[model samples]
Target: MRVFTVLGPSQAGKSTLVRAMAGLDKEAGQKLEAAGVVTLQPFSFMGEDWGAIEVAGGAENLAQAGPALAASDAAVVCVPADAEAAVLSAPYLRKVEEAGLPVFLFINRMDQTRDRVADVLAGLQTYCAHHLVLRQVPMREGGQVVGAVDLISERAWSYQDGKPSALVELPDGVRPREVEARGELLEALADFDDQLMEELIEDQEILVKEIYDVATRTLQHSQLIPVFLGAAEHCNGVMRLMKSLRHEAPPVEQALARLSPGGRVVAVGCMGELVKHLGKSVLLRAMNADCSSGTEMAGQAIGGLTMVAKGGNGSLAMGDLGRVVKSDHLRLGQVYLKDGARALPDWAQPRPATYRRLVTPVHQRDEARLSTALERMGEIDPAMEVTQDEATGHALLNLQGPQHLRRVIQTLKAEFGVEVTEDMVPPALRETITKPVEIHHRHRKQSGGAGQFADVVIAIKPLPRGSGVTFDDCVKGGAVPRNYIPSVEAGAREALMQGTNGHPVVDVAITLKDGKHHSVDSSDYAFRMAGKAAVREALGEAGLVLLQPIVKVAIHVPSVFSGNLVPMVSGMKGQILGFEAEQDAAGWDLFETLLPMAAQDELCSALASATRGTAWFQSGFDHYEEARRGDFGAK
Candidate 1:
């Protein structure tokens, strides 16, 4: 059996196409409850069994498609018939190109669009690295697509509901268009085949087999992408698409060679993990060798193997995806070889997290359970991350966007039974003094027999940015005992934890100018209290300012949407640094700017809305700058 992955934007009919190919339901698009999850379906076409791995189509879920693509024989990219929808395919196309896999573009919902195939191809060409060739030209009647003329075979077929297309005579009105598209397809094939080029130049008749051979070779080499038109909902043109895949898609051995350079036996690709009722099951794709019960993988024996469509499989053959149960040693994105296990070289890393929320269990006693559930969720979806906020000591759930975070929260409640509440992550704010001030304090506590007596005078001064708190002993003639000086410094450092603004004080220096200590009553506790009280009095005298964290962000989007970025950034009170055209990515631009950490979530949401979810940004901590106290409600 051969395996191929179907990917596209959400609601582009990817799941519907997969279901149609499997002969399950032609109307599956209407009942798409599991649209954000990866599913595997099996089907038989022309006596050859095949598997289709349908990946989540949302832009936020693109990270899940990497492992699926890496482990498959080829990729079938399903895109809507609308021309503007082509931009949404950019990221998926890049992934398939990087994996060096043969890719096919299926123009779904052809019956619903009036746009010509030429215009759609032109829009997609801007993003694809490979030359796209139209394999079939749509045959429309009354402005509705009813059939397609195959460019390779020059045969015409009329679509039928819930069945294979019926053969039809070539209509005269469609002949000219068919000839033009066939010519273009031949020309594209000629670029990679010298013989075909000569035949085309000499105007000689080309055999169907000759065209197929050229198309197959060029496609496997990633030189050209063949486009097919179809309305998967009506089961129209699906069989034709399947026939093309069966003949033109690369074999399992060829896919293995592309994944691993040399021909090595016993290679298994771990696509992902599925948490089942029995236990955790590792989704495995056999790239080279057949895997069965007791097959040694990643230094662990596979207790059992189960197929996605068929249960209790005896053995998983090459190019087939199955689940391995009762095994805890396998990991996602890892390729198991005879020598050792290693990560898939072309596996995509998860995008940078932009949205964050502080998550806590509803019940305090379930904190441990929540932590365990989050750890498992991280393994299931690498795009979601769990981290600790240094300033507040809260567990922050970092995700690609709002939708990604919501899915995680839902999973925590439904799957793990760990109900939780979420809140916005607090900004890590800092406080600093504006000027220097001198203060004196005496911590005298006369309680019963032993009295606590200590005195100290300290001067506090503001320091430059990024210069953390500093302590200096400027006492003359040891007026304050040397042994007791360390305690006073410790107490002063602790006092800076909460300043007048209720934030940690930074960029300040304190000096021990003078102090009096009794030989019998000058204990560390007495001096510590004196130091704490002195610093409190000094901070009150000196004014405090709040500093907000600033981040340097790099935003990438199609150049067509570049104009919308400036205003969006300005609305967030950000400063634009500069921008330039992205290298190697045509029609795309990269912009750099400085933005406040508090507005990162808003920026992400705004970009998604403005760019139709085609824009993404990465940010890092730059520095801390003084901010308006009113912004944070600081007193």
Candidate 2:
């Protein structure tokens, strides 16, 4: 039994489709009588059949049902003929693509369109490029979508009011145009079957088994995305889609190809050996195995999982076919790094670097627990480094990007109960003298314990950019005792590491040309104190400038929306880099530019809302530059 996600825009007739496929009445059972929420209306077929699974609708309901929706195995993307509905439907499709989930798209309400099935098929050719593959040619009756001819099985099912009617031979309307469409889908599937291609080129009818096997492999590799016809409102063409899924959905063995090159189909590994994360309750994670080559799903046992809850996402143990699930939503999969992918035994892959100046913890008191739990996260993804930042107390966890962050955070809360809080860290600033200065300092003290005295004359000069700080022992005849020289160096280094603006100081050379030390009373401690005194005096007289961080951001927005976003970024102190036109990848213009880091916060949500969540972007830290001199905020 394969799990498939049913994704589409809100009210694209997904609920109605589920009812029709489940053999339930749309008007009466549309709400799924047993289940209060109609979103995840699981329709289980024959008690013994490795049946087809249908789950949930998209939109307000979909977002709230995230945990349940992600648990699906494959997806059925529904696109209504309505323009606004289709435009909003892209987000759901993009998510399925991002998850690498195998999906079959249903072009709903095709009977409402002006053109016939052939024109729609031709236009869909360039719609998603390689991401889409049409599997069934839409069957038309009197200008209405009455049924579909399965390109793979060559089986046609004519429907009336949502039910499959008597089976018929391939119809005349699709004969000429489908000769090419069906051949194309089969040809793409042929790489998985040489004999299938041979029979096709020779003009010989290919057997159903050959076509099914090839199509399964193609769907598993995401090379062919089947498009079916449906009109849930009218109860049209739903049952035919259901029957096709029973024979079409790829077996577990084929889908594993995405995880690795063909490896041996081994026996399923034993459970309980894995380290299950303990939250309020224990949560187990398991991996999928190649069970298609005759492994009986009935042989698997659900031992020791005695206390079953009302509902939970994990193993789907129905007699023999046992599958591991991570979330209630079937679109998501278990996150894993290929073995031996990173250097550190704990590190699974090279973690991505972090350019954010400050990282705020997402929840309170989460620093310690999150650190312990995420140590393995860095191992699986070498690009991450999880720890605490001493300066700001931020749980400094570096990651690849926003997607990686979302996944980790979800797993942490749902699996570990680590409520995190974020405290954004402000970027470090630099203060360098705009002009050179010479300074002198003297200290004298007399007390009952002992008399103490020290004096120094130092010149601080700004070096060419990149010429680091340097100090010379120019005192004549031990003007400053050898024992005290290190102390002076220590004091100067500390001052440089912490500048007047509470940032690191750079690009300066200090010369200790003259200094006197009391032979009896002078110590390294006194000299160290004097060096600290000298730097403070020198920097005060030397004019200084503050440097700020710069970052590069690529924004995707419609051309009409760019007119608004461009000025928004500019107002945030960004420099417009350039722009280019694109198609589906970026609905409109791709805006690329460099901007200050301080302006980036909340930009993601802003962009998403601006484009109704259609836009995407890549932002990176570039370098540091002097901030524009003026009032910090409103004058």
Structural similarity to truth (TM-score) of each candidate:
0.90, 0.66
Q: How accurate locally, in lDDT, is each candidate? A: 0.82, 0.54
Residue 541 deviation, candidate 2, in Å?
2.0
> For model 2, what is the C-alpha lDDT against the true structure?
0.54
Q: Candidate 1 clashing pairs? A: none
lDDT of 1 by residue, 1-635 (tens): 78898998888899889888877333111111222567767666666667787888776878777667777788999999988888887777766776778999999999899998899989888887788999999898999888999999999999887778889999999999999989989998999999999999999989999999999999888899999999999988888888888888988888788667875635554354435365556677787778888887777677778765355677877876677767766666567776567776744566677788998889998899988887766655666779987866668988887777787877777777888888898888998999999999998998788889889999999999889999998888878989999989988998999998788999999998999998888899999999999999999989988998899999988777888999999988899998998886766789899998999989888998888888788999988889965677855
**Top candidate, metric lDDT:** 1
Regions of candidate 1 where Cα sits further than 4 Å from its true position:
24-36, 262-276, 337-341, 441-457, 474-486, 513-528
Provide the lDDT at 269 for model 2. 16
Looking at model 1, residue 350 earns an lDDT score of 62
lDDT by residue (452-528, candidate 2, tens digit) is 66677777888765466788667788788777777877876777776667767777888777789887667676777
